[model samples]
Target: MALAGWICLAGHLCWMTLQCRSVSGKVLEETYTKWLKYKDDCLRQIQQDPQPAVGLYCNRSFDLYACWPDALPGTTVNISCPSYLPWVQTVQHGVARRRCGVDGQWVQYSEGELWRDISECEEDQETHTEELWMKQVMLSFRVLYTVGYILSLLSLLAALIILLSIRKLHCMRNHIHANLFLSLILRAVAVLLKDSLLDQHWSKPINTHADVQHILSHRAAIGCRTAQALMQYFVLANHYWFFGEAIYLHSILITSVFLDNSKCLPYFLLGWGTPLMFVIPWVVMKLLRENKECWAINENMYYWWIIRVPILFVSLVNFLIFMKILKVILSKLRADNKQRYPDYKLRLAKATLTLIPLFGVHEMVFIFATDEQTSGIVRLIKVFVAVFLNSFQGFLVAVLYCYSNKEVKAELQKCLRGWWRWMQTCWEDQ
Candidate 1:
């Protein structure tokens, strides 16, 4: 019986350590908010002052029961977070026990009013590394996302202006390109607002997890929520455009059928209109079902999952289509049939190569990244890869589909020569 009890205790301790390792900002914030609320609840008890709750300690152990100084003898409490301040459990001694002392002042930490011990908040090497890794991944994402999204937005706009300026550039593919670019622009704007406004939203510096949670909970605006929805909608829309491109390529390559206006009507509907199938339902669900302050916009809850499910499906379908296109291209290459119709086949092949990567089928590589635990460096690298693929994809599309086109180069050269000639004429007149 003694051995069994020891084994059970050890198992429980191991479980605690597992729970405490590798924390997330959201979970930490939520747990801290709850902890603060608990303190506030206690302070309100029997008309007690708020200050009483700040460092309220009891004879009870910190890890297993009530924290206030006057709790019953058998009660236990859990001590977690950093020794200075913690909202949730971490690998840093996440689960420690504190039992109430019979004499009524929580187990000693000081000679004066400070009162209480947190000596057990020690972390093992693995847990310490996990904590560092989590911080590294977060810092990487924060820095990379801000830089990549902003620059991608600017380049996307430049590409759109170039495409729209020349009369000869108008075609079904350009129409698709225009829509894709617009989606990216809106998504970038939405993400920029969300990221940029985060700091200014709260008056305080948000030094703790609880502070972050509090600001996130209260920072809901109709405009911001709508922008979030719009961003998600457009993000999915852009992916669909990639799927559309794959389908178009598959058609042109396999069947040799050009994308004409009549054939493109369905593609347009699928590209521009299909996202509504997901976004409308998400918006309606957010407005009608969710009563919270944030309204499930930034919260990756039910509505967000609804958006994600279709995107995952769209990604899978596009990948299959892309794979099929590759097979056909490889078969064509092996046959040497391109020699019979060199120019047309070569252009088609070049177009396929240029546009394939921009479709973002490669994003699947990072989809399951967070599902498993890895070292911090690996996580950061995966984040960089995913961020680069998703964020800068629009810029790549703009460059490949519009700027790099032979016709666009000729048009640009023509415009520059005309400007040069006008300058010379002005000089002669002078």
Candidate 2:
């Protein structure tokens, strides 16, 4: 029953793909058709070839990716690089190799997989240089974000510990901060897990004997898709939690009388439950329309917008609330600063700094911007800035709301002093 349902779903997706009217959808359909034609030609060639008459000869076959021919045991067969792939232009003169083992079967790349060694197909010097440079850039970006997230994760964990452990710090604001910290921690973890599951080097398909119809199945591993979905959920939660923080602050400033009885339940729901509204539909869209390769590539803008639009909307709302809060704060500061202007200035500066992270107003700069539309140094700079902002945001928030908060600092100091006195007293008694 389950298999039948999956077949029906797959048939529906194929029907949708064929009937798609968008230019990108048409291109995708054309590419798929071209691959099917190529596979048919390979299979035809394999069928027309004379069958092996005796022992010690590997059979002719098509491995869904490339065609293999009958060969003597222990001999390697070489074929021209396939022309169907986009990268084939660079490797026009290149060859793909596959080995036949002494046991009269195609030699396995691993215990259960057969492979064509396509390394030679990527040996063009000029193309290799370009790819190498791009790979180095990617490696640098990955390393930078990985380190930043690890630091942020560790810092946020410590902040959560402090906030949860210290009873004196228990308040609505601190509780909200703890939720924000937890969301950021989960986002970092999701990002790391998604990266690990879908990294190009690790997730690249192992060529094996399989039908062309199942090629996408090999590429789109369930684990990577699940990771991608989890990443989306956590990322949305992180943004909406920023929205929740803004709402919390706005309420405290604008509706102070209601604060004592306000519950964290609503904020929790906003932070965690709301992402499902966007992510579930986005996942369904990907599965039905653009199901390929870890759900990372944005093939259809409309489907991509399903997730991007909500994040932008939340950020914009947060920004507006932040501006209103700032205005109210400045007005109050002016009215209250008749006697102590310097202290007022300091307090205002602290408030601005503190609210910036809580509201996540920094995202306003590049919220509508994308790196893909740029080139050269502009693209590099945009990517770097985006990564730096995204990766270090939790760390900055933790520092502002927990590590550097005067209230938290005072509590830590008081705790340290008591522990020190206890140690001294025990020493004297001993």
Candidate 3:
């Protein structure tokens, strides 16, 4: 019996270590280590002490999940829920019960495995219903975003091909658009891959032994971490490319003629190279400080800010430049009458619409909103708007700048005429 107890304790310690390392990073890991150490000392003291009146009571021991004190025969022993459980925080004062048989041995399942009843730790019916509803809501959100990304992917790909195929459209402005399209494509792919990886590995029936083992194995897996890092890099790159677009537009309209060079090297560096600066450090910090679980959930705000701050900086800069651009456009419209530039107002409207999504100025609507800060309908609206904008921005940009551009339309018409002439010549030859 003593050997069995020792083995159970050892397994419990390993399980606790794995659970801690799977979530919330180093802080929870340290806390669980201290807790397991304390429990070990208590168990050791119990071993050193004399037996409790020989066979009149159940021996104090650790089960594979929790510790229990000695109890009189034919009685039940209850303890506070184990802190190592993922859901324990939701039921801080919950209890777990273990029954002692009349023979003074801890009860076991009919199949001969030890059982500890933790039903009290489970959520009540109301909470379970709420959880079900939340799951449904989240599933809807996932579907919506997945569809949006798919559509965006197709649109962005078409736009990129069109921009590349038309030689007349090859300029610094078009080069910036191509880079932006590429970044969005990569971002969409990364997000889909990351979500799929998580769903395949981490999404499972909670509290099952198989589920726990599955999570433990994948938590530190290189594939999961690599997916996470790529997601971060591409997300950052997408935002920086938005900045690149804004900067290029601002340079042409506002900056001196000398600054408006045809070379796209600067925009290329900004769009692709700049994300490495933040992503490498963010990866290092996560690996060193909070390395756990596909690097998706960070309890350390500082490490998260490494990725977030740069994106925020990009957004803010783009917004300011957008305002300046708007001011210039409005001033130009005011200076020129309807007779001077008859379609000036129409062109101004199109430019304004195009730049809004390109600059990501729409993000400011939910920039300050967070899961902690908002609840109820406000959070619902924020989430819906965020998902809609984020998923469809690529599509919107493709439509505004590529499919709807007069220059691209002219190029497409020319290509079609040449193709028609070639087809006619081939038909005559036949």
Candidate 4:
């Protein structure tokens, strides 16, 4: 299952990367074309009525006459003045020209060929702007891609550890494992697609603002929505599995009534299938509203909110139910004089308590904290907090429920010991 998950994740990542590259390329092409058109318009306007004396500024300090011999289109020309400053600026039509000489003293360029210098300055400015924009984009891409890649790799390692800990694949852990794998795969793909290949290919020129917006809207609306829905579904399934774990513990530890009910069939379906019913509405709404971007709340915000409210309410209810079951199990253990089980119970309780506030109540806070009236800094902080909390939920569950369990720890240690002995024997033989 873990291997399967990794394969799926890789495939999705490749697809998303390709899609992003394609979209980015289209955007960049459109932008460049628009910029070309703007440049052409400017040139045409200049030809209609040439200015007598155009002053070009260099690096905000030096103003000089811009004059060139030839009318070159789609090329850059470098002109040298008495100044050695490494900055340049241009003004198309003006009389006041400033200049800095080699001595670093400011002077005015009252006479000289102005048109050529202005053209060169404009060309250099455009080039510099493009380079700066590309550098900014590349920096953003590196950070996003690096973080995403590391997380995906670590998730794969965690999955492998889980799979190797058990002898058989069909177990409670396996069910949770499947959900985690699916989530990691989809998220990795989404990240890779958005950050890497697509962004590189699609460089939007300034004039193609509408096209860029259109592409961004479509990608955010459709691509991001699909990814978000999948993530939410997987999260819901994983939590359901945790709830199942609690139920199984209750049956075995407190009472034997549900021993037979702990089988994988019903739990498996409920874990994977139940979220679909809730998710269907969002998917249908997305398709129907197929606007530029996917909105959390659309034209029928009330209707959508009504649907979402129940899901949130149910999650809280299930959390409460899990807590009650946990309390009962712990009480029973304490009465029976089982120290080990009671300690385990305490751990489970702590995990549940932490999660309830983290996932359930925190969401409400996030919603309330967001407002159009809020200052930009406050809004930014609120958004960051919400996103961080939401992502943290999945990771916390994996750590607290699976990695922190004594039973799981023992099994993992045994597996590692065996593997270590095997490696030792092989080394000795060699």
Candidate 5:
């Protein structure tokens, strides 16, 4: 039954496909649809050669019967820009100014020149320079994000192995860490795959934004959509596990009413199961929405925010619980008898540093304001800060909870000694 359930879940996830309806998409559809109809007519005529002609030769003097390039009567040919340049627009993103006259033939460049497209998209020096600078800065951020996450993954794996290997390290607290670490690993993988999907699309040069859209429409668009959903899922799972971290502390220090490990039950349920409520609605809405995007990144941004509310609530509740736990610890600490609980205060402090940065609740600072409105140096700075903070989350957690923990440090030292003694014995035997 468990295996059957897993198969059903996989089938459901694999069935979704994305469709987009951007303004650029509409222009592309019209441009190609016109040409395709003309090609079909030319092929059927079979006058001499069967292939459709690019354009017909016409005299400079207007001739009443002069044959022109195949086009609708009284309609100008609309040429869309290449996908790499920008978009098919009059002002921004790259636009073209080639038109076929009433003769159904393409207009010439001049008396003796071939037609040349009037370039406007990033045509100005300032706009082109700004775009180049933005691309370079984004490239740097991608490098930092990828390298940092990979390093964090390696560190988290090493910490988990050490925690599980030592009998002394196996505790409820470490269990929470294990779950959070796993969530981090999964989220990082999903984000990497999402970026990889975009790389595959834009890697090769395509003639128009329409071509890029068409390629994505027919290709593995579902893969990109699935990556996005999984990223959302695992990111939330990581935050909820942080909530579990706070809950664990709350149980240990404030609420002594629960039996040993009973608190873990609620943590497990919330960490794994609560996301289903958010993800289900987002998925169903995406599948049913009229938009073309395989994912829910639409103009109104409703689909994206559906999951955001839950994350905000979780982070807020966790923060409150964490503060209460800290208050309880301070209240329990007697001033004159402070030496009695020296290690207790240290544990509280470590937990504070560990949970806050690990889950990135402190990132609430920039959550409301992305760099969409800003430009120039301000946008670059915002991008840098966001990337730097998010990239180092797993690193901070692993360093604080595993590397800095006294028990883990002592266990690691013992492990090195064992390995050293084994090496020495092997040398003697040789």
Candidate 6:
């Protein structure tokens, strides 16, 4: 699955790069031709009449008596003239004919005007470099995601092998098997959808005006928006489920009473349903605001602040819960191994040093970083980080807990070995 995802992402990026390059090349050619024609006309006009005044038009203002000398044809020079045109002269030297005002009007000087208007010509060069950088960053992220995906898939596969090849690990205790199955299924779906939809060609190509309109329209853009919203909701739900697993584990270890709680149901509902509310508001705002883009314009910072507040609260709550659990578990473990093994203190220290940085500090940094950004590359990176953390959380938890247990590890190994042997034999026969 990881290999397939990489292949798909690579192909998509190549296609997008080709399309962007083609469009940029055409724009550059057209802009260059237009600039050449304008330059030639200006030069011809200047040669015919040396003192000819031309009007230079810009965004919201215009210069009426802009002069064009034969030496610098396409460029504007300051000119002084009659009652209508006011003039001011700067330092006058050999070749430097520096005059300030043009006609009677005080000419407005803009630094930006002095800069060449080569946006179209420079776009391909600029974007090509940007594209390469994006590709490299994306490739690194894809590799990271692929590793996580493969590990999760392997965990699921190991679980299947346990169920089929052995009885020990498959034994039903406190609905652990059911929880594992559901978690695996959810993780698989989340990874697959994310890898497929948001990977590379997520945004459609804007070839023509109609294509741009379609991309921004209510219907077409809704799907991408919906997918994004759904991904967010599922990610939250995945974490909620992992928290449930921890709670379940605690219940089993401390009380030995597994209370079947459907409390997770409401969480699941909110996780899926609440994001729909955000979507309605977004759609309404998009429609009423009449933006060319599908998503909310986010012109009002207040709207973003409002949206971010709840997410910030939820993240804080989750972080607190995680910290509290870690503290409790470590405290218990330390008390258990107080005197018999002095090295237990060393182990606990190592665990604290490792887990605190991995789980606690990392999550806090991610939450804060994500909340700081609006929509852009920063936001995209945040989404990627969030998804990666959420998807890999279950596997990490399983490893931290089950992998260290001798009985669990033994059962897993036996099951995997048997399954491998069977597959090897079958392959040999084939």
The model with the greater TM-score, 1 or 5, is 5
Ten-residue segment with the worst summed lDDT in candidate 3? 16-25
TM-score of 1: 0.67
Error of 4 at 109 (Å): 15
Per-residue lDDT, model 5, residue 96, is 41
Candidate 3 error regions (>4 Å): 1-46, 56-61, 69-72, 86-94, 103-117, 204-214, 217-219, 257-260, 336-348, 370-377, 427-430
Cα lDDT tens digits for candidate 4, 245-352: 544554654664533554677656655676677667766665666332323324555445534554565556555555666577566667655644547656666755
lDDT of 2 at 125: 71
Q: Estimate each model's TM-score.
A: 0.67, 0.73, 0.81, 0.51, 0.70, 0.51
lDDT of 5 by residue, 147-266 (tens): 888888888888888888888878788887888888887877877887777555334334443444464473545766777678888878887887777667777777753335555666
Question: After superposing candidate 4, which stretches have Cα over 4 Å from the reference?
Answer: 1-157, 168-170, 177-203, 209-260, 294-299, 329-382
Model 3, 1-430: lDDT tens digits are 3234334433443433323223333333443455567567667877887766655788887654567888998898888876655456787888889888898788888878665777776546686576557656766877898998999999999999999998999988898889889998998898898777765554443333343445555443567789889989998999988988888888788994323456777767878999999999999998898776678666778898898889888888889999999999988986785448777778788778878988989877877666557887788788888888899888898998899999999999999899999999999999
Cα RMSD to native, each candidate? 9.3, 9.4, 5.1, 13.2, 10.9, 12.9
lDDT against the true structure, per candidate, is: 0.60, 0.76, 0.76, 0.47, 0.61, 0.46
- Candidate 4 has its poorest 10 consecutive residues by lDDT at 60-69
Error of 1 at 6 (Å): 36
Q: What does candidate 1's lDDT look like per residue over 1-430, in tens digits?
A: 2132223323333333223222323343444456456655545652553333444345221221223334544456554533323322454546555455555444444553333344454445587576556656666676777777787789889888877887777777777677778777777887777554433332334333344455556343444466567777788888887777777766766764434534668787887888989988988887777634334324545565787788888888877777777777667665665466546567557756675665667767866544344455686678677777777676676677667878879887897898899999999999
Give the lDDT of residue 8 in candidate 4.
Answer: 31
Query: Which sections of candidate 5 miss by over 4 Å?
Result: 1-113, 117-122, 205-213, 256-260, 263-265, 290-296, 330-352, 370-382, 426-430
Better of 1 and 4 by TM-score: 1
lDDT of 6 by residue, 162-278 (tens): 454556554433234335434554656655664454333235553333443353345654544555445544544444444445445445445433344434454344444554555
